[model samples]
Target: MNTSNMDRCLRAALLGIGLALIGAPAIAQDAPVEDAAAPVTESAAAVEPPPPEVQAPSLEQAYQREFAFLQGQKADLERRLAELQDRMGAEQSELEAEIRALEAEVVEMGGEADRLEDRVFESELAVDTARENTDVLASTFLQADFSLAEAYSPDLGDRAPAAEDVSGLFDAALGVLRDAGSIRVEDGEFFLIDGARVDGRIVEIGGIAAYGVSPRGSGVLAPAGDGGLKLWNEDTAEVAEALAAGRAPDSLPIFIFESTATEVEKKGTKGLFDVIRSGGVIGWIIFYLGLLGLALVVLRVVFLQRASASTSKILDAVSGHVRRGDASAALDVLKRKKGSTSRVVSAAIRNLDRDREHLEDIVSEAILHESSHLNRFGAFIMVIAAVSPLLGLLGTVTGMISTFDVITEFGTGDPKLLSGGISIALVTTELGLIVAIPMLVFGNLLSGWAEGIKDDMEKAALRVINQYYEGRARGVESA
Candidate 1:
């Protein structure tokens, strides 16, 4: 049976059973008990009313139903939110992709721009080179009408270029001529002055005359004043205007306006001294001292070397005075001693009277004094030798730093970039060694020579003292 029919049949059977049982309960009431007073009457059995239709719900069931409903709503909301989030994520991804694509396009455009710039630069160089060649060709085909005067300026042929494109040739031409001292870089140009082209050291460059070309063969090169440039047109005997450079402190990097055999002859090979003064304060001081030291060496070799003999003779004279018992005279002679040894002996002689009782004291004092003088410059020479090498080492360290910086900045593809600094550092080291060795050697030799002279002078002074005492003894014997 279907579930609904089955439930109805079961309910009918339960009702019939209840009816049968109800009659039995009624029969059981047939024996009515006698009751006191008011109740001898039989009472019907009490019947319970059918259970009231089940209504409302239990607390647990109510809670469970409410929880289920809330769970269902939460699940629905989660699904909708998830769908919205997924859509947003997709849009974001698309945007990021689009941004990446735009960035790539921008990078490509930048690279294209750089390439185009490089091409333009190359084209400019080519045009410049072409113009220089044109100038050479034109000069080679100079007509009789054309004339060149001072090295600074020259007149060109009357024929102008047929095409406007050909004028670029003059760009290189004018630049070369300007740099050569022929014309001022500021001068605009000398375009066919008086139907002829005149170019030279232009004192003043005027403006492009609205009417083209000046009446006289000369035209304004640019709007006007002068830049003190030497321009000359020897054919016209027109002298160029320029500031005199002869009195400048150092040689300037000026190009020759005119090539003259005499000027080249006069200016022989000039190097570091002309290019730049050694810049650092320390370097400047070192160079100046080097010059002074060089001068001192010359002085010593030429003048002081000759004076040493005279110094020796003075020692001899000092000796003779002591032997003659003229202590005052001997002291005066000692005062005249200027060399290392002489100064030491003079120290002893100055106190001869007090030192007579202890000659050893005299000798000691003199030896110490002489020793100090002899070694005075020796240590200085060694120091100079040491300092030079140290300076070179410092330079090497700095140069290496510079080399590394160059490598970091623009790798080592081109050695030429850093080679010069390295060369300078190495060359400086060599120069330092060259300077130090001779100085150290000479210093040592001079010290040794001074010591030797001091020793000889002391011995001679002692001899003179001994002789004077001997003469006194002989006179005592005669008495």
Candidate 2:
């Protein structure tokens, strides 16, 4: 039995035992008291005399009776408990069966819900696909309508049908396509290259190309920006005449076009000066500075060339004369030579009889004096190099300012309005770099070369002194 049923049976058994015990105490209390005196009454006293013979129940007898009663109650409770347990068992079986059936139903319902969910998802996907297809169809229809209107007939503007009327639009587009496939000749007045209009037979080979035949001139035709034909500046008169006569020419000369509503102008190449002029005043200043820098470089090159001429040969000849103990001849050779090295060597030769320290000081002084000429224009060239890029940056800042000013005034609607400032910005920067790079490179190189010449001069003067001292020592040794 279940716990609840067992507890109920136990409680019923306890209640039966309690009731038997309580009834035994009540039966003992109801017995007549033997020691108590009977009330005096003639008939009652006679009847009480007979009642005195009645025996009260003994303790053992009373207990035995109570036990017997308890036994009966217990049997009764056991019967009731057995019936309750049987009823409970049947109910439990029924409840378990119902629970199992409910669980099966729940499982079936869950599977159905899953299937419904899948169907819902598939339906949503199909709905989205249909929406996308409709959008594609609408977009394609609108684009086709625009292309037809622009390429074939300007008068067919905005003639798009409703979304449901796709068949009608397709029919119209197909008819226009068929018409555009063949050559058609029409009497029209077209403009010539010189802007003169003349009556002509315009032969159109599809919507792509056209040719004109006229008495004044006959050639291939181009759009004149007014939905009219104009003569192209090409020599295709024979082809135009052949098309006009309905004969296929050996070579087909035609001008293909998309629309005649917009004029097509030929673009010309920009020259160097035109490009420089586009950079405004700053660009021109940079350009002139570049020219001046070039001139300075040339002058510096010439000066350095003259200063370093025949340096090695002069040094060799002077050293040879000094070694032969003829200081006068070496001095004559130095006088004849013309260079910073020569001047330095001559000073050394003149002071050959002096102490070594004095001779060295004299040579250093000569080198320092010649440096004034060797280093000429070097600082200026470097300054120009350093300043050019900064000037370019200045031009760029001004150009950007101008560009922003244009934007502030006109709201940036047209690119052409802003292109001028942008050109100035870019061109000035490019020109600056172009001028500065080579100047910087060549200026450093020239400075290095001048320093090399000075080193050579010092070496030549030192060699002359060394040769003189050696010759004197050799003479002393011979003495």
Candidate 3:
């Protein structure tokens, strides 16, 4: 049955049962009550009301109605239960389909995850290799003395270079190679790996050579054994200038070493004495002679300084005494004074009693004698000045001979051996000039001083002799 019919049937059956139960109660109440006292009268009989007929529902009919209603409800319940079961079944099927789809997706996602992991592993290895290669390239640049790269080296330190740093290095290397034959100057530094760090201006000639100079010092940079730089005591001024000027003449030689070997490092700048010593034995002889000449110069200067003072006053006093026929007084004045001039005057005064011509001869003799004393050690100084340069020449000749002898024995294959002779040849000649120039200057100066003093003495003696003649003539006139 349909739900509506079943509901109507159930409602009708309940209504009938309710009506029967209510009617029963009403009919029982309506029935006359039996009285204990009996009193029947003609008036009571006439007023009596008749009882109404009320029927109760049949049991069979009620049972049939209830049964039919129950049947209809059961069918309706069955129909609804069927519908709910069908709905639950459909929902279960859909959930199962969704679960299957999710399962497949999980499996596919797992495979994709594995692939991503593999790719990530390969990427890691590539990164590691790149880092290692970068390290090696940086170390090569330092060891090879690439000065331009040194400017960026300080930032690298002992760490792996970043992508940017690698790219920058590549670009810089290409740029350097483009101008490989040209000279370049850059602000850079020298890292000794474990030693000192020097910051200065660096000069480079393509890839062949590099040098650094600062207020501290200057030296060529050479590849070190420990992947760093070493300072070599080599002159590279031409290269430095070319680098600074950004150009060079082909004839100007750069700092290209003979064999890429590290040059010997000197302690400091060599002095004049050191250069002389490099000339060897001959150098020493020239140096010693120079010292002797210097000593003689000092002594002669002192002697001349003392002897060349003003002597005209002493001469005047002596001449006055000689003119008055007072030879003893002139002698006393000469004894009191000191110098070559005084001695000359004393000698002339002692022979004043001689005739005028004889007096003149004696004075001349005295002045000649004083000249020897004035010229003391003058010849020795001249000899020293002349000998110093000759000794230097002797050193040069000996050095050259030694050089040629080395060539004959060894064929001059090694410049170091050849340099031994060359240094001696050049240095000794330099030392000789160094010695001779000063000695010549001072020697001549001392000689001039000595000659001036001698001339003074001759003048003083002649003045006294002339005065003596004048006084003697006056005496003759008085006679």
Candidate 4:
């Protein structure tokens, strides 16, 4: 039998035994007294009481017992569950407390960060305020110094002083004056003052008006509406000569005031002339170059621009007068004419008997002398034209250097910062070309004209020789 079968058999035997013990009657199985036992069975049965019988339990009692057992089990389960719940709640409380502590730490850290940020912001503000104070120019009247008389009561005249006290006072005043700063500048921007439009204290002279001398040399205070400088002649307003607008040549502006009169120190104006001189070196060079070219042009116009008829007029007049037997008139005409041809002809006429070939040589030499005088200083203009552009190129090199410096210092993000060097480069080049072109062109043109005149002089000298000396040779042959 398998284990399950054996177990089942055991459980069945136990159940049957319990049932037999509870309900079954006892049976006698003896053999000696069997007849006796058998004859006395009915009476013994009555005398021996039947085995007491057991009844089945009632359904109500069984149900009550089962219900009580289940109730006890449920009570034990409730006790265990309550213990587990209490342990879990304690753990949850500890975790929550830890979380609260961490949150408080985080809040404290955040407060520290805010405090540091506030300190940084306050420091930055202080630094910005300091920088602004340093950079700002004095912008209001409160920053300016008031005059001594304005600051003090005007009773200095009431106190009399000894000679030593006066000297000491003068010395003290001088020291104060020496230590005093520059005159206060006015904030001249247009602002609404009272109700009228008034300009700043900028002095200007009028073109249409004249200023007479001040009366008794008093202050030149003029009223706002009348007796002031006239911009133009008008019938409406009562106008007079006074300081007015516009800076014209030969105009002067006089400023006068009570209390005290202030003037611009003009401290930086002394170098104005030097600045102009430095900037104008190129201009001076160009001007001198032009003047030199003009001089050469005048010389060429004088000697080279001579009339072609100069020799012919004299030669024709001389031949005509000679045909009429008027040698004196012919000589007079020759004397009036200029240039080598007339001179040679006049010399030949006067010398008459010299070797004709030698006289030709003399005329040639004189023509060369006149050519030299015509071309004076003509080469200098050529040099100026050649060098001017080179000078401009030098300026361009310097400008590029300065331009790179500006880029390094200020950066090229804005083109206006670089424009100054560009102006220098471009303006110099333009001026150079402008100056060189005229000089180069006119200088060569004048030179070519001088050369042509020299050639003409040579030709005229040969013609004069042919007319005078060649004729004399033919005359000797005729004789």
Separate clash counts for every candidate = 16, 0, 0, 0
Residue pair clashes in candidate 4: none
lDDT of 3 at 64: 74
lDDT tens digits, residues 129-227, model 3? Answer: 987887787775564345565433436667665677767666776676778777678887763323577787777666667776665555667654343
Candidate achieving the largest TM-score: 2
Q: What is the C-alpha lDDT of each candidate?
A: 0.52, 0.83, 0.74, 0.54
Candidate 1 vs candidate 3: which has greater lDDT?
3
Q: Residue 468 in model 1: shift from native, Å?
A: 2.1
When sorted by lDDT, best at the front, the candidate numbers are 2, 3, 4, 1
Q: What does candidate 2's lDDT look like per residue over 256-276, in tens digits?
A: 899888776666898888878
User: Which is the leading candidate under lDDT?
Assistant: 2
Which is the better candidate, 1 or 4, if ranked by lDDT? Answer: 4
Q: Write the per-residue lDDT of candidate 4 for residues 295-412, one digit (tens) a residue.
A: 7667656665563346556656676554444446767887777765576556555543467677667666766666566666677778878877876676567667778999999999
Q: How far does residue 479 in candidate 2 sit from its true spot (Å)?
A: 7.6
User: What TM-score does candidate 2 get on C-alpha atoms?
Assistant: 0.63
Residue-wise C-alpha lDDT for candidate 1, range 395-424, written one tens digit per residue: 556667767888888888999887755655
Q: Candidate 4: TM-score? A: 0.37
